[model samples]
Target: MTLSSMSETGTCTDIINLRYQDGSVGSPSKPQKFNYQDFGQLKQTYLRKGRLFVDSTFPPDYKSLGNLSDLPRSVRSRVEWLRPSDILKAQNVKGEPSFFVESASRFDFAQGKVGNCWFLAAIASLTFQKDLMVQVVPTEQDFEDYAGIFHFRFWRFGKWVDVVIDDYLPTFQRELLSVSAKTRNEFWVPLLEKAYAKVCGSYSDMNAGLPSEAFKDFSGGVHMTYKLKEVHDRNHDEVLWGQLTRATKCKSMICSGTAQKGDTIVNTVADSGIVDAHAYSITAVAEVHDGSSNVRLVRVMNPWGEKEWNGKWSDESSWWNRVSSEDKAKCVKRDDGEFWMELEDFCQHFQILTICCENPNFIDGDVITQWKVMIYDGEWVAGRTAGGSLSNSTFSTNPQFRITVTEIDTEEKEDKNVLLSLMQIPSQRYRNDERLRPIGITVFETPAGRIENSFFRRNSPMKRIQLYGYERDLIEQHSLKPGEYVVVPSIMKAYAPGKFVLSVYTKTETSIEPHHEGEDDDDDEDHLILPTPPKPVVPAEKSSVYDIFKSYADQNGELSAWQLRKLLNETIAKGSSDLFDWSACRTMISVVDADRMGRMTFKEFSTLWSKFEDFKKIFNRSNVSKTGTLTYDELKSAVQAADIELDDNMVWLQYSLLQGDSSISLVDFLTLMLRMDNMAKKFKDKSSDGFITMDWNEFAADFMFI
Candidate 1:
């Protein structure tokens, strides 16, 4: 689809356009659709129908796949296609499989052979608070129902998605292959893990990732990472303790990991029982007595279920002797893979600590300041480009977001907080390096009216942060005044393809929306020709192509995109049979029709035609590779041959128009040449007044048809 058609409305399309046919967006304030079949509703429907829930996504196909007893662990290990009921029929208790045994807890999640201890540690932390786990793995479906289908909801990006899978799971030697529960009866852990794997493409994709990412997905919370060395060096233990205490009070999911020395495995077990470069779930942040003084302590849980921290605050440490009996009962429990360590010791050993703080008033329903979240999915490709950060002289080529903060949080003493997060899709399968793209986001304050073109980069930023490596997802918190702003997310390197979800969390009444699709800024709409003043006659020196275009021109020297479509159909097919067609005509018009006026003046048409001829000359010179066209890599030389300098955004737009193709055709090259001229002229007109600006009406006319 053309850029104009994608963004013509300048806002979210109707339910039909959004494909939200069955339900609303599901915001906290939006009306809850009683008929919507989420995990709970679907289970209740099956229960009322007196039938079991059989997930079609993954079905019981034991007879076709061979008996589970005969299947090898490596057989079809790549595909997660076995029902828990088929294999665990003997292990199951009475009926079907239970998603949870009694209630889900830290003891429920155990790390299997897969090196996804980070994920398991996050899961263990998830079980510390009932409200948090329920929000994650909703306790809606039960094993007694005998339904083979089980579903779990995860806070994906900003919305909750119900991922349904049959009780089938990946296994090695018929045992769970990935993350599993400590007990076979408690299937929520493995089932949830399989569903997540399904969402992430396959079980292998989850082999390695940051636990903070899992925490963010599970809790729908904002996560931030603090370096342990920085905290200790700064002597901010009390400050860190306060932050942890507040997070704990709000029921946040927290995890810490030790740093690696050299290339050693982070999960290496140490002689003292503390694993190096390993992830541990922080169970509690409390103060306990240590002989003469009240020592601050933080409790941690190991997913291995045995490697206890034999430190000063270990389960049998002499420090426990100073603790009062009542305090000991509340803090220490049996050897459930949990131990309390001095906060000082915990900080000294761990290198990084991450906390996924729940949105304000989410758990207790204290609606003093309601928080609403929105998510947008976007991507970048090699030939298809997204912009870099705003700090660069170049405007960002990535997806753009326009957010208007109409109301700021005034009740709290601190300034209003806007939580912006970008989570990159895991790229482990493709890269041996295993490190994901280093990513970050920048927000700038723009005019309140229509969005100016990306080339209009004069707008000053409200806040900007540098890029960070993929050890964690990119996150930023901004406290700002209520106004209009734009957010751009990009990788440190340009033109790298990375799929990501951009999530924005703010107080209710604030709105955030995607401004561009990293291709073109033109809003999508039907071809609507606006009335313009009569154009002067075109110079006679123009090529015969002008005469061909004149056949569809009006008395006012105007011709519509439809007219251009007819001309292209009649002329292009006669020469290069596969070169241009009705579809190409639409793209051609989308390029030159910058104002989206649909029709071009005779002067405008002549200018575009001459530019097209010039592009042919440049393309002919740049085809030294003997290819008929120039690949995106060779585009700079082609532009140099044409004696033009395309701005950052225009260059990105041209490559995006190529749509992942390595090369650009004669017609596509000409389209880019003319679009750049049109945008440059408009931008020049706006900048002539010292600042590039747009009023509501001007913006609507320039970008949106509305």
Candidate 2:
């Protein structure tokens, strides 16, 4: 059969406007550009359950540092806290949570599965000073807890801050979430105040999620301040940083932390500093996870800064062992915070903070010795760990997520072996709702950048931000930190295969850490990268060469030589990347046959051109560098010293010769190729089988002078 008997894609209007054959201008259907920010304002007419899901692995316990050989397995196994270093390491790799952080000092004790606020509080205090994280204990050996703490005094608007603690978190009687978490979520009173020193704004304002709010709208806000991020060697680039605080006087920003089951250290840095999206403090010596007894350990903060080791003690391993000999407990591996990777999977799994504190300001007497943990509130990008299955908001009706928790048995000798205690088995789609969920992996790439958030449900808002467009329906406010970004639809769709106007908006600001009260302002501005350049405007690509020919054929109700040449030349000059791209263009053509059966329409030219504009743009006169058209010599000459001999015109001719009735586009292009293959040869060798493929009107096509 001829090429006209294939499937139908979209309907065509005229030479300028093309829509789906069904009359509606088709939208750019797949390879979507999702507006996570104003999703609420978007037209909710979704092809329900049509998207795939995303998932990843969490940090592993076996990869944790330190040993717990002396402690019981139950306590060691059940005890777990989120580490700042690990979170920062993960962010560095996957580059997720792209929201830029303030250069201010910050801290937060991550409540693991057990929700031990007490332990998180103790760790929070340790973040105040490098030694505090070290002095605090994680083991039950000498004074009970073996975890240390660090502190760094934060100055926001003004006034000194104080927050101290060493206790366990309260648990829910019936449940520990949502309504169950109202008390813990509430600000001040018994829970927030008793443990905290003095909340930032006042005892009444801890709920504002300071540093966050302060940075959002305070005198020395996050926008102008400067920070020093030297977690690595090359920490000196002026362009990377955001501007310094426009406000003259700097205020202190501090977080409060409760205590842990057993931790030491009186004071540390007053408040840990922020780096990228993380906060950190120094620890005296650390005892990570070990299958045996609770190992004495030091805690460290991720100020988005470096792991600092001053070498106070001569023998590195004398005071505390970086690596434990007795403890065989499973340790949580440090890796990228945003993406998931198996803990035991080589170097990608775990990472230790490298010490790099050389600033004279970071002296023994200057370090903030006491700190409290704080949690900022805003548009949070939420994700879950690897799941065998996934359900909706609840897990009772249909357990969509089936996770396996490995209980570290430190009491027994067998637990010390690097064996997985419990592994969650991957569950096939069973529940009806589970199948509709965005559960597997859905990577959204737009003009702004890339958003790789994993959605649990079909319509769950994994990405929440300000609203836009369409009156009340449009979510207008955007919660973007300086250096953060967003995607917006630019133009109204006309020839657009789809109906949407999206544009990318990147914040034109930097992220710099604030300065100490007594410290001088003379310092190098590093870490904060300048805002990305504004996006360039791109024109919508017209139809392809073949599609144009097809359109002319259908309009005139017959195929003519002139129509064929025009289509062929158009395809070569505009649609394809040179005449040769006709083969590639044909490959594009081969996909859409246009009819009900296996046939193609003259309009495939338009369809193909619109789809592959970026690729086609490479062949334009602009890239060719010639004034109006590509000259014959320019075509034959090396397109650069790269690739092979030129065949721009031949490619154009071969595309016209392609018979819609029989054979493939490739075969047809090859036939023309075989006809003039030898044209490019320096001196035709009689014995050579290749034919010369040069243009007959070389002189006429040279100057582009019509």
Candidate 3:
């Protein structure tokens, strides 16, 4: 499968084109289906059956309310589930209820009891851009053909998924409990909110989040965040202003949040009329001449549809007197929750500013500059591909994507040509239950070939973005010379299962593809060759080890592992420092136990004795330091010397599993070799067409023994 596709316009057109059957791209082996509930099919079926549709997937119940502990006692006690028709009718004296009163606007909705102003702020900002608005809330549906079902599309990871929800909404005292519309007959706000809540697993899961997080789910675009505290510097303020102005001109979605006061409760209203720890949308940004100088002003909207900023340049402020009639008229003041604030006060009050757009040219301050975007979906499967961080020996086993930068932007001195975004996909049915894994990305300048563990051992990463916390996404911008590079995404903890999407945005043309070991080369030539087994050590002519083995054997002439261990320590390992342990001796017996018995007969003992002698000589030779333990490389060489076949990845994995303190003892090495032999033999006997399928019991039995 292709790793990514490029687009010059920086739009989602390339992604749209890449989409296959259901607007999904990437590996077809396991494509993600959109809106598992088929709206059209369900609508027709329900209509034919003379019934209204009800979504069983996201039902109207306490489960949909999420964790009961998060709900207030008052809300939980009075909560009543109601459909839109019931909600509108209970309010009394309303015309036929409609999904939307008219064209949706920022004033259409007001935040309810949920502490999700961040989400409401993004929804308010979305209203300003109708094109983006329609992408999320399709304009095709209405009350005219109501089936009690509504679907909304959201950009999830790298694909758009349609989330369907029934019209049932939670209400308290006959009023919608979440987001409610200003017009009583309009039900779009609450319905849309329900759909989004379903995507988040439940309404409670939507509590307390960054606007940028919702903004990404809304547009799946390039998101840039600015820390307002950092903008206190004059130079940084100017840069931020330039970017915000350009972003506004480009019609990008923007939102900001107020910093929390010391131990202050969230949404606590201050005397200044601005809520503490609340989110707001930037509806507009302008610079007006106040007869003296240009005054930079920003229009901010509170999702509550009330409680607006009452400081200077506010709706009732006398600051409008200084500006000309034209500018004053353009900046109309009202009590609709939207008011103007001076740029200085805006920076002083807000802690974070976020902007998102399909095209990120606004970040460069040059809207004409277009970028090429590429996206890829990948997963980290435990044991096989979840190879943890760079410090891990199996890091190379993680998925790797190779990208070649063919050109660079020459307009700037040090252009950040590449932008990497790694987003982890949630694996739980409920967001509250999902524990996000700490994920990161590493980039390395390398030759145009598949990288292996050896390469990672010999080289260091050119760039690393380490997020040790449980962040859903990690993004970084890098400036590098034109060359081939490999990007590796991994979880901080080894062998943790998860999925992710990696998006690459470059200023110029680039090519990317997933790299697999030996995919581009001859497998036979790259395979490691095993050396000839060393000759067995001879016993003293008169003594003869066979005669000694009979003494340790029982009446049946069979030697158990305990007996074999005694024999070895007394003879072969008598003067040698290295000695066989009970576990190693047991594994050795298991390896050659053809009768499935725990003991070895004389014939079996003879065969194992010769191999054991050869292995001991090879191990001693490979352990040049005579440390009584072998490093990863030394152990690998010893295994090869004993004529055990294994590829580089397998050898690395085995060593990682068996090594302690970066090395393995002779006993551990012997056990490892024996287990590998048993596993290989089992696969050869059980596998069909190179794939083995075993039930849980069989798998558990084999795993325990192996």
Candidate 4:
């Protein structure tokens, strides 16, 4: 069946007349233009030569830096890589190089050694839907055409990217190590898995993930996660039944996960023959007519292809006898691990349901009436913009976008759905302890044309902020009226840098323009201007370091990293290298940071700074270079200048540990100097042998961790 016969997707309309009327959507970064060759051109190139497509974006020839041992000890794990020829036999049951013996099925994707059942379940669900598999794993590739090359496309960030891969796959003793199809000869399953693994950087990266993510990536669609309890609270069991049926009709992929007890993962089968903490694909949701009346039945397939719910409506259950033989045949697919269960039983068995809505405008032949999606790449620079939630502050300084929705989709019963997805850029691909920061987007229905600071005014109401309670690549869909809206994507922490892709999908004609903050040249200064007089400086008595910190930081509830440096510059010695040390201050902040939230509360800042204040003075007095930082030799000199002494080996070890330039900031200098002083002072006691117990507060105060 063709794509049009399978489902109806939205179309894109003409660009409306909406230009940047005011400030930027988020940060001040210039809008990035993606200029890769279109799929049409790439396809033509491949067909002309019968040569495989090799994605230039993420080249297949690239090799990964082995399981990153450099990652934080908390997250480190090993990964093994092998080739496909090392695993598969030369022929299958039919005695041919396994490309495909027959059409792919839900049974084709059985879970293997990898713990990516969520991903496998999504692939299985796609097999039942005609065009989804073709869209993801391009049919243009086959074993006969394979000159050791294959390519597949996936929806990533805000666009579909073609990922190329070789037939080589990880294996052990001629068995596929990761995902494998039931038939040893079938190459499409492993080829698809290999292509997907390349898109994620490594096979190891797909070890654990959500099926909703896989569905969204497989189809350039919007994903929504729903809790079973919330669905029940909203209405009756029939409500979810209608939803599942509609999803199946529209070819929207759906998957469910069973809840397990406690934090421990349980893989053993339950009494019902269903495995807890496992993902299962929703193959079909049908309202079959029984001899007495119509009954709602949902067919679910386990990726394991063995365990299944043996409750009512199961393969051998009495409920099948009540239904017509034709209906019974449709419900029971015994050995495939697919079984029918009543809609009510499904709700009881599954804890989470995730659905992916294919892009409404994603049609094959038509362009108009389809959903037009706009994707913007943005970064949250710590000192510049990456601020917390807008409810706590204004997102006027963050990246901002002006989206004008001209018309809503009139074809569907529901109003136009605006989907906004924020995805953080992937990082630390090889490292086990990859760091992640919470990120979210806030959309405000502003006056058609407004400036940046307008939203920051006192008590200005916000339309929608923090739509999803938590961050981590949030997706929020709203049925909104056709109009102009301003959106700002931000990291949840103040001054924490993060990169993200903001995807906007609307079932209408929408124009997304970056809001740039600039004064119109038309506003001329023809009138004579008067010279402004210099403001008089206020002279006041000096206060202690703690008192000075409270003065500058009281304006905002938290003290920023930059603010800390300014405080040190004013309260301590001026023109010292320590005063301008950004990296050192950041490092120092991490050390004193209690929650690792990056931003510091006033009390936390005061406690950390009070101990280093004396050392700042000592470092400042010895600042001959005045660069706001000192080299190892300069730091050593300053330490000796302060009459503190340490063994050469000890001094060298401390300096070597300093990151970046192997230099010391005011914070580091103060920390090192104080530690040496504490050691010397304690050594005066004959019984003291370099052992002293320091609380968290004392540790921050006494150490200059260069």
Per-prediction TM-score, please? Answer: 0.60, 0.18, 0.70, 0.63
lDDT of each: 0.61, 0.23, 0.74, 0.60
Question: Candidate 3 versus the native: TM-score?
Answer: 0.70
- Candidate 1 accuracy as TM-score: 0.60
Q: Could you tell me the lDDT of residue 121 within candidate 1? A: 88
Candidate 2 lands at a TM-score of 0.18
Most lDDT-accurate candidate: 3
**Which window of ten consecutive residues has the lowest lDDT sum in model 1?**
1-10
Question: After aligning candidate 3 to the native by TM-score, how far in Å is the CA of 487 from where it should be?
Answer: 1.0
lDDT of 3 by residue, 265-365 (tens): 46789898999999999887778877778888888899999998889889888888888776677555677889888888988888889988776667776
Model 2 scores worst on lDDT over the 10 consecutive residues at: 241-250
State the lDDT at 616 in candidate 3. Answer: 67
lDDT of candidate model 2 versus the reference? 0.23
Query: Ten consecutive residues with minimal summed lDDT in candidate 3?
Result: 1-10
Cα RMSD for predicted model 4? 14.4
By lDDT, the better pick of 2 and 4 is 4
For residues 1-706, write the lDDT of model 1, one tens digit per residue: 0001101111211111121233445332222221122555666687788876665433434322222222355564443445666547634435555677777777776677656678888888777656656666767666666555676666654455667666766554556655666666568888787667655545545666678878877766667788987997899887787667656655567788887667856567787778877788887767766567778888888887768888787887877767777666654556777887887888888898887765643222233555666666566533223444454433344566788888665775555557777877543322122457678777777764334445346555665335556644676777767887877777766544466767777766677776633334353221111212223445667647667776666422456556676665566434653355555555555455433434565665666666776777777888788666677656767876665667557666677667435677766666666555555566777785656776653454443311
Candidate 4's error at 465, in angstroms?
A: 6.9
Choose 1 or 4, whichever is better by TM-score: 4
**Candidate 4 lDDT by residue in tens digits, 97-181:** 5656588777875776656688888988787666667767767655654455666677665445555555665544455556677
- For residue 543, model 1's alpha carbon misses the true position, in angstroms, by 44
